[model samples]
Target: MQLIGLWALIAATLGPFQNVLGWSISGALVQGYDPISKTISDLAADDSPVKWIQSSFFLAGSVLTLIAAFSAKSLALPGRVALFLAGISGFGYTYFPTALVAPSPNWHVIFATIAFVLFSAWPLLSMRFDKRYHWSLRPLAAISATLVMGATTLWFLLTWLEPGQPIVGLSERVIAVMQVLWLSFVIWSQWLHQKKGAPETAPELAYGAKN
Candidate 1:
């Protein structure tokens, strides 16, 4: 149960985490959708001077979570690799000032999306496997993952859809709230189902691990 709380807490931290990092460095609130908007904006003002403090903050948090997911035994090799990539990408974006105001080489964004997708899916897959074959946490995992993935998807949609309009509009904020809250629940579920008695260790899918 305590472990459960730990997972939820970590998941919940992401929202305020980014907000503080962005505001501290940029001196302004960033788009909840982009999360990295403030960082990039600061760079644009100064030819994008690298914000090591803020960037490292984000990277460290992400890496810690990835480690927890691994420690929790919810992620496997593929998910770990993807997470590593995500961390690297995040670090690059935050640590290096890009000439473009927004992230360029659109493919970088795509890769990040893929990372998050895998991140969200692993838990869902683990829960399903547990519920169907092992009577584990499949249902809870699925529901939690669904909520997170849906929210993340909405984030992508809102931020990418209409650039002329604000990225952190009402719809996007709503999705961010949902993502944070539900992702917390998913983490809690992972903590709850971390063990299924004896040799039947938890699934790697929970932590975005791939076979």
Candidate 2:
């Protein structure tokens, strides 16, 4: 869980900063290239400068995310499944790097959509009705996270479809940051709760008769 939270913070921090670094390193050739409007793939195109940063961000983040998903025993089964699919989509982003001047960009769109939806929905799906795990995933908090993420996604979609808006990059960044922060908070909250609630004695002596 700590690993997952740590990686989430690392990825979120790196995501935009890497793009800025790539932009500066690339001489910003793509005219009027709005970082928020243009996709991460733009920074990772074959002709783009500092392509490795974008590639590494997606590839490394995907690996860590997959590990986190598999090891996240605290999440419900559906949440884990959603995260696993999100990880797979993150891998797909690397496989289908979008080119600014490419004849077709649908592949990138498809993969990105998968990633966005899964990540957004995971919070809602992860809500626990049993109350035992409510410390990390209360119904109201999980629902709010899901709704906010979903709305952010809608804003991104609108920006993309409109093409005239200059907020694409900003919207994408917002989504990424929100999800990462949420994941970190959830994991940290769960870890703290577990630590506070744990028994001092060994489990072997839990139900013993005056042992």
Candidate 3:
């Protein structure tokens, strides 16, 4: 179980790493892709020349995230559920790539919204009050992380909703990076705690067993 948890944590960390790398490389490979104005999803749009690259990355990230969700026993159940749903959302949006000339209210947009909401809110859902857990999973720290992610997500939403918003892509990237970094921090912290001889079970579980 400990080995499985370790691999799960590593997989969770790699999800974000691959996503960031995916967009960076795909964006560069496209002849006229503009990160400032175009969102990451644009790279996987039906008409995108390098759609395969971005789509492949999205699929890989989602699968890795799902692995963590099911196998990272250090995380509270609620957090794991959130990660699972987020992974599902990732697959949804990736599989339903946006069409360059499609109308609004598409599946891609719906799934993307769900993904962002889950990502922004997962920290709060996963937090534990136990001091035995990592500081990042503490109530105060989790609340702060959630607030920061929520605020950035709100900024991205505003840019997305308002037509002709020049910073839409930039704002989206900012929030995405922020959320993933927080997740990575939490997972890595838990892995470190386990390495230092902390109990393998989640804090809540350990507390329950103690009682």
Candidate 4:
């Protein structure tokens, strides 16, 4: 079962990863900067396989995650389902056409933002699943999620590099990195939760102590 879960994770990463979402949804940035003189259109072009990679990876990951979560009750069933839903919604939003123009990604970005929030909460909710889950990691994940969510919400009032700056892509990239860390921590934490009672003689051996 562990091998199956790990394999599913690796397979999902082969093509369907969450990061490509930004490629499709963040397309608006490219469109916003589009100019006849500009030579970067190919970067965000839909013709690229970035969408396929993201959509497929996430699709596969969602299915695998569902299977993994179901097979292992170490995490809360509801939380896992929410995570699965978040992953599913993320794939859907990645390709949805919200922009009539070349690369307007508003719709994808909007829905993806919600998906990110859901994804971030998966770890925190996961602690509710098993008593052996690392309590320390739960608080850390919660704090990270809260910070990311709050910062993203207040992005309008506080610009990353200042409003109307000549180049403004750095902030989004930074935020993306932060999101990646937050998500990685969440998933890794669940993986750890799965490990909490592996050595137990019985499933209830150390559930409360580990909690």
Point to the candidate with the largest TM-score: 3
- Candidate 2 minimal-lDDT segment of 10 residues: 1-10
Better of 2 and 3 by lDDT: 3
Taking all chains together, each candidate's TM-score versus the true structure is 0.54, 0.76, 0.88, 0.53
lDDT of 2 by residue, 136-170 (tens): 57688889899989999888877865757777777
Local lDDT at 2 for model 3:
30
Over all chains combined, what TM-score does candidate 3 have? 0.88
lDDT of each: 0.46, 0.68, 0.82, 0.47
Ranking by TM-score: 3, 2, 1, 4
Clashing pairs in 3: none
> What does candidate 1's lDDT look like per residue over 1-211, in tens digits?
1133453346445644563454355443333324333223242232434444445555654565455445434433443454455445554444444335555555434544554455455445445443313233356655665566656766655564456554433443344344445444555545545444323444544444553
lDDT of 3 by residue, 1-211 (tens): 2323766877866867887899999999998878988899989999898899999998988888788888876667788899899999999999899886666668898898888988888888887776667778878988898898888888898888687988898998898878777777778887788677656446767778899
Backbone clashes per model, in order?
7, 3, 0, 4
